[model samples]
Target: MSATISPLAPKKYPKMPVIEGVRIATAEAGIKYRNRTDLLAMVFDPGTAVAGVFTKSKCPSAPVDYCRQNLSAGKARVLVVNSGTAKAFTGKKGRASTALTGEAAAKAAGCSESEVFLASTGVIGEPLDTNKFSHLLAGLVKDGKPDLWTEAAKAIMTTDTYPKVASQTVKLGDADVTINGIAKGAGMIAPDMATMLSFIATDAPIAAPVLQDLLSRGTAKTFNAVTVDSDTSTSDTLLFFATGKAGSRGAPKISDPKDARLGAFRR
Candidate 1:
């Protein structure tokens, strides 16, 4: 959303493919900025698997705690993300904001509160007003579509000069599957994990545990390898969602990260 793009940014953004069972919508809630989107809502079909890597900072954001607790469920129905005021170091108010936002997202997605994931970015220690955007969840869910990757990436950006996105298609067993990812980072570059926030979606039929293993391992070589500064942000978060819609196209279900059938997809 900045007037200038990063010199290291990709010359041209890739065309993001739509993954079945995944829908996204973005809104401008005026949480911190005006005339630009700052809220993102992503809905996943039931049974979608999820994995994540977050900041190692001891004082993490409230949304980080909310996600860590719900990750054990191994299922995801919705994701709500915001940029501007990170809900961190605000004690009870931070927790209240996450709970209220999660409840709103769950109601809109028709899923349990335990199935919703949340992430926030920007200035830390500021009390986030969940009401600023929580009320827009129902409308986002109703208007969401599967091809808004560009807008979704832009909505969650803070200091980043440009939206970062990547996509790849590979054969998962006998079926073809696609991976689409978007990331936001610039100033807080030394991610213990990248205020770096990233989200990836795939149509592969992989289980949550396997997705977790793959994501954890992948982060070590990618996000965790970059260092832009000595300080790490408390709001850093990365998440992946697998919708398993590829199963209908003959992709075999994978429950183990070491499965030889995923050889090509692993690379």
Candidate 2:
């Protein structure tokens, strides 16, 4: 972690609210930084829908490829992310690392490997040693809680001066829903696609297809429009997860992109 927070950092961080059906945990795996967190586990409820946008870079990271392959499943139960190694350009070793990590995460979260998403960012071309943190996943999942958004964001930081987080509450029909997001980036950012690493979660009951449509459109106008150094990283990823917990509160399950009740959320 950077010793100094960015000058452009928010003057006052917002109090992040817990999103129902999502619990997070962080661990100091000693992947790179010492005495600070470097791994994050986000455990989701069963049937949670997922969507994502990744970098346009042809040489993407191992986790990027792994995530793209699993995105077709649309359902997610766990997300395991780490900092300190992009795990790009390491050939078969990178692929093996992701596989090991995925299997461990799936076992820990009690989900299938296809439902476990992964992301990593940091030194490129260096092979990430999954052994460093894969053994810690079970404990992380067991201790996960919903109020760890800030810690979760910090665990994924590389060169980032501070953890990036934001939240919003909106009405989906007459039911209230909340959205929370976390991101990490300091340099080598550009609008090739997502530009940086970000993960968002919502309590809205939206289908994966609708979430994908919303994420794609939102990226074009937001993350894809931003630039820093005109350079993009091999691990640029933005993933969105909808846990559908709001359905119990009267929020409608929206599978159609044109659903009228999503007006507030769409805006």
Candidate 3:
């Protein structure tokens, strides 16, 4: 996090409300900075659907590869993100670090390693010391709460001067569903895919395929439409998750992007 806030930042931040089935926690791992948060963990309720889009760079980060491989499962239970280490260009060591983090997150969330998602940003090429913070995951997940959107956004900052967060409530059928998102990036952003790193979660009962379609379409107008210095980072990533908790409130489960009920959300 920078010592100065960006002048373009919104003067009045939106009030973020709790999204059901999602809990978040942030910790200080001293990865690069001391006495400040550098790690974030988000635990989603079981049955949450996930979708993602990554950088177009030929040489992406290890965590990007890890996430791409696991995305085929279309299910998510835990998301672990950190700053101070991009974990790119480290070859085998980078892969090993991602594997270790995924395993630790899986163990903490009591889910399969394939269901755990990870993203990292910061210094590239240098090996990330997982030993510094991997053990803190279990405690973070155990104490996670649904109201840490701002803290979670702050924890993933690298060059960002201010935390980026957004929230909105939309009517899905007769039920109102909430969506919450956080992102980090101040430079190395372009139109190749994600501008930096973003994570979004919703309480709507949407299927994985539907969520993927929605995200893929929405990005063309959102992240893909933004630019900063015309440089794309190897760690650019955007992940979307949907916890089907809203089904109990009369929100119909949607599996197709063409569903008419999504008209309001797609707008």
**Residue by residue across 152-228, what tens digits does model 1's lDDT show?**
99999888888888999999988999999998888766756565789999999999999999999888999888877
* Better by lDDT, candidate 2 or 1: 2
Cα lDDT of candidate 3 equals 0.92
For all candidates in order, the CA lDDT equals: 0.91, 0.93, 0.92
Model 2 spans > 4 angstroms off: 193-195
Candidate 2, residues 1-267: lDDT per residue as tens digits?
567878999989999999999999999999987898999999999999999999889899999999999999999999999999989999999999999999999999999999999999889989988999999999999999999999988999888888899999999999999999999888876856534889999999999999999999999998888778888789989999999999999999999999998899997
List clash counts for every candidate, in order.
0, 0, 0
- TM-score of model 2 (CA atoms): 0.98
Model 3 alpha-carbon drift over 4 Å, by segment: none
Model 3: per-residue Cα lDDT over 8-49, one tens digit each: 899988999998899999999999999889999999999999
Using lDDT, rank the candidates from best to worst.
2, 3, 1
